[model samples]
Target: MKTLKLILIFCLLFLFTLSFAQTKGSFKVIVHKSNSNSSLNKVEISKLFLKKTTRWKGSKQKVEPVDLVDTSPVRENFSTEIHNKKVGAIKAYWQKLIFSGRRVPPPEKKTDIDVLKYVHENTGAIGYVSNSANLKNYDVKILKVE
Candidate 1:
């Protein structure tokens, strides 16, 4: 009976760990605190980042989407999860848009700090970072993706 109890405890712990484990390719979208967007799902984020939508529905503030460098893992994950496309594919899409004179891609920042700074300074700016980022000291708002 003791052995069975131990085994059951181990199983419960394993399941709990698995449940709380960070999701694969997980990312967080952040915006300036002034933006007042509490949450945005994948479609709204994709549209904003892709420049398909220009303004925040809340305050009608123009949306200024920012991007991390293409080489960052967060950027890659964000490209995959939010855009449902690889980084190269997103690049190609941007290229087509640029050539068609339809839209310009968001400015790419070199690091998470830089992206955060840009978002912090610009009321309309929105950007993404890794799930592990420590945003405790930052004045940015993280928008939930459901």
Candidate 2:
């Protein structure tokens, strides 16, 4: 009985550790290389993505936030970690906005490379991609999330 209990405890601890690691998904926020801001806190980032904030601070340039497809795992993690909401909830929020004609969600790209391309080409664009994406060749700036 003692040995069995010890094994059970070890298994539970392993499972807990695994879940915690999985919850901390990896991704990076990026913007056009010319964007002046170097970093932004989560709240600021969230506002930009949600369309609550329309322009970059201290600049007349309009902010063009982009999103990954609803089905992308990077989008799933970004929705949870940055927006503190699930992807489905985000979709619903955008749907209501579109129905009311208040706003539209950021354009969704199908892949990280596509997002990189968009951000690189648009001076006011901001986007996120999986951490594993090859950004070496892209002329984009990785924003530090505070």
Candidate 3:
């Protein structure tokens, strides 16, 4: 009986560890070098993602934000934790905006390296990528979400 109990406990602990492990990849929010210093609240960041706001009023430059591919863990995290919406809900919201011709989705990159490169090169760009990826060479700034 004692041996059986020990095995059960081990199984439960293993399952718990797997469930709470840091996601396979890291994620981070990056901004263009020009806007590196600009402080943005969660609302402003969400507005940008939803395409509700397009231009940076202060710089008079167009904003270019990128999103992770649909259903990706990073994307899911950003949508739910940062944008405060579920995946399906955010998708529906974007569809409506696209249909109205009010906004277009941001460019999607295959990997964090690509996102880092794109944001670093574009003056008005912003993107998210895994946190594990090294960002030493990029000129972009990483933003902290509240």
Q: Where does candidate 1 have its weakest 10-residue lDDT segment? A: 18-27
lDDT of 2: 0.92
Instruction: Please identify model 3 stretches exceeding 4 Å from their true place.
Output: 1-26, 36-38
Task: Show where candidate 1 strays beyond 4 Å.
Answer: 1-25
Q: Kindly list the per-residue Cα lDDT of model 3 for residues 41-62, writing each as its tens digit.
A: 7888888777678877588677
Which candidate leads in lDDT? 2
Instruction: Please say which candidate is ahead in lDDT: 2 or 3.
Output: 2
Q: Give the Å error, residue 107, model 2.
A: 0.8
Error of 3 at 97 (Å): 1.7
TM-score of candidate 3 against the unseen true structure: 0.78
A best-first ranking of the candidates according to their lDDT comes to 2, 1, 3
Could you say which candidate leads in TM-score?
Answer: 2
- Tens digits of lDDT, candidate 1, 1-146: 99999999999999887866545446789998877779888998999999999989969989999999998878888988889999999999999999999999999998888888888889899998777777777789898888
- Candidate 1 clash pair list: none
Candidate 2, 1-146: lDDT as tens digits = 99999999999999999977775456899998889999999999999999999989988689999999999888999988899999999999999999999999999999999999999889999999988788887789899999
Compared with the true structure, the alpha-carbon lDDT of candidate 3 equals 0.79
Candidates in order, TM-scores: namely: 0.81, 0.84, 0.78
